[model samples]
Target: MKALLILLISAIITWTLALWKTTRVTSATELSSLGFGWPLQWIEQDQSRFQWASYPQDARLTFVKFDQLPAYVDWGLFAANVLIIACALLVIYFSFPLILRMFRK
Candidate 1:
């Protein structure tokens, strides 16, 4: 039950962060390189993004680009993320008793 709760909390957190970052899309269109890491990931727009016009008559819409697709659907990355989170939770679960013992007078 603790692991499940931890997983839910982690998912909520990452989802919140993803939404926050995505709310403000980067204006820079030039992709210098991939920035895949624990903190952030910069996959190619070509890999998981598509160009779409927000308005039919807007001139700037012609160059539309999305930096990320939804994370939930991306199974490979999502699974890896879940695995990392589960491991972290397991560590916490195992060490929690030790921590409580240390706190006792």
Candidate 2:
């Protein structure tokens, strides 16, 4: 039961953080910046034509036609985050007994 609760909590936290970070991405650059050290230039989009290049570029400029990022990328990041957080939590929970024993000595 405790392990299940831990997993549930980890999933919730991971999903919340993922949504929060994902919403902030307005451009390819912002998306690439999500999760520590995500690959630079992860998306390959065509550059604006020379005639239109002189205009000021905004977030939509990077997106071009896409309204949102690829679903697979978002899911992959979420899964990775959940795995990392759950592993960290399990390590701490399991080693807690050893830590307590050392302190009692």
Candidate 3:
């Protein structure tokens, strides 16, 4: 139960963070700045740009088309995040016992 809870929490957190990061990433520079950006970019590169209510043609009006985003982008980021987060969780789980023993000394 404890391990399940840990994996659940970690997955939720990792996936949420991945979604938030990818939603705003429109260009290579933005995605490349992230540690997981390379893999996420590798998954897809067909980001669509759009402009809404562009009376003034401001930067805010012209942005990536998040509403019409592709499925691969979302799922790709989530998959990468899950894999990375799961690996970290595994390391922590396997080493936690050794850490506790060291603190006992």
Candidate 4:
């Protein structure tokens, strides 16, 4: 149970850090009109620049399209979180009976 608790706490901390990093990076970046859902006329008027100046890179003049960008989710972090939860649940479930037996004796 102690080990499981430690594992869960570590997983939570790692996930929180990763999430914070993602949010910070995203907040610092910008998206262009290349893949925005706005109308063509609006895009032509340059209204689709979302947080264009917040990022170090200038996405406005980039030739790359938004759809070609990689996904944001970290599968490894998600898998670690799921594994930690499962281990914590298993530890609690198995330890409960042992604890009750000790109390009964």
Off by over 4 Å in 4: 1-71
For each candidate in the order shown, give its overall lDDT on alpha carbons.
Answer: 0.45, 0.49, 0.50, 0.43
**TM-score to true structure, per model:** 0.44, 0.46, 0.43, 0.34
Clashes of 4: 0
Q: For candidate 4, what is the lDDT?
A: 0.43
Worst 10 residues of 3 by lDDT: 54-63
Q: In lDDT terms, how accurate is model 3?
A: 0.50
In model 2, where do residues sit more than 4 Å from their true spots? 16-73
In every candidate, how many clashes are there?
A: 0, 0, 0, 0
Better of 1 and 2 by lDDT: 2
Top candidate, metric TM-score: 2
Could you give candidate 1's per-residue lDDT for residues 29-72 as a string of tens digits? 32222233233432222312433344221111112355433222
Per residue, candidate 4 scores C-alpha lDDT tens digits across 1-105 of 866676677566544543333211233323322221111111111224345445444333222365443333445545655565556667877999999999999
Reference-based lDDT, residue 27, model 3: 48
Better of 1 and 3 by lDDT: 3
lDDT of 2: 0.49
lDDT, ranked from best to worst: 3, 2, 1, 4
